[model samples]
Target: MTPPAESCPALVLNADFRPLSYFPLSLWPWQEAVKAVFLDRVNIVAEYDRHVRSPSFEMALPSVISLKEFVPASRRPAFTRFNVFLRDKFTCQYCAVRFPTHELTFDHVIPRAHGGRTTWTNVVTACSACNLRKGSKNLRECGMELKKTTRQPTTIELQLNGRAFPPNFLHESWRDFLYWDSELDPW
Candidate 1:
C-alpha cells in the first residue's frame, strides 16, 4: 500500500544537483513539488511507485527534485540559539560534554550583568549545571574554562558542522546527495 501524501516529501536540490541546504535537509511537500514540476521550475530526478491523480491526469510523486536555477548559499549565518548550539557541535563549553538541544543552554562569556551583549562572540553553549554554577560570575571567578573560544561562525563552517549531525529520518535516495563527500573507509 502507498504511504500517506505527507510521508512522501521530495528532496529538493539546487540546479547543480546538490541539496539547497543540508542542516534542514531541503525538502518540499508533494503538492509543491508537483506545482514546481508543472511550472517547469524543477526537474524530477526520482519518483515513488505511488501516484497522484487529478480529474484529467495522473503522475508519480516525485521523491527527488532539482531546481532549474541555482540558489547561492548565504555568506553570514544567523546568530540564533540553535545555530550557536550547532556551531559548538552541541557540546558544553564548560564541561566539554555534548548534550541534546533541550538540555543545553547558552552562556555569556562575560555576564550580561557585567555589560556583556548577546552577540556571537559573547555567547557559548553550556549545560544546566554549568549555567547555574557560573551564574552571574565572571569566568575567572567561577574558575570555569571554555572548551573552545566563542566567535561567529561563517555559513560554510556551520554547514560543515551540521554535516556531523544528520536528521532523524532520511529517505534512501537522499543518502547519496547528503554524504557524497564523506570518507569511504572508517579506519
Candidate 2:
C-alpha cells in the first residue's frame, strides 16, 4: 500500500548542505516542503517517487531539500530537558546507562535542598532509579558518582552528540547527504 503524504517528510539541510539539526533529523512535512519549493526558498536535492498534483501542476514530493541561504547555528544550545538528555548522550550520569528518552530523567547534581540552582552546571541526565535514590540529597550523601562533570554544552558539542542518534526512518535519498563521508565497503 502507498504511504500517505504525511509519511513523506523531506530532510531539510542548510545552504552548506549539512542537515539543520541531527538529533531531530531536521525534516519538513511534504506540504511545507512543497510550499518552500514554490517560494524558491529551497532547492530540491532529491525527490520521492510519489507525486502530488493540483489542477495547475504536479511534482514529486521532495525527499531532501537544501536552503537557498545559510542559517547560522546558535552559539549556545537551549537549556531544555531534551537538550540536557542530548548533552549527556541519553545516559544516566550516575549509573552511566543509556536509556530511551521516555525512560530518562534529569537530576540536579547538587540537590535543590542543598541550595543547588537549576542550571546546566548543576543538572545532569539520570535514570529514574538514581533520581529516586539521590532524591533531595547531594551526590556525596547518596554515595553516587557522576560519569562526567555537568556544564553548559556548546552548540557544536550538542550537534556532535546529536549526530550519534540518527532518526529511525532514513529515506534512501537522505543517506548520501547524511553519511557521505562514512567508510564504504570495498566489495
- Compared with the true structure, what per-residue lDDT tens digits does model 2 show for residues 99-152? 999999989887888898999999999999999999998878889899888889
Cα lDDT listed for each candidate: 0.90, 0.92
Candidate with best lDDT = 2
What lDDT tens digits, residue by residue, belong to model 1 across residues 1-187? 8798889999999999888877867889999999999999999998988899989999999999999998988899989999999999999999999999999999999999999999999999999999999999999999998888888999888888888888888877777778844568777
lDDT of 2 at 146: 93
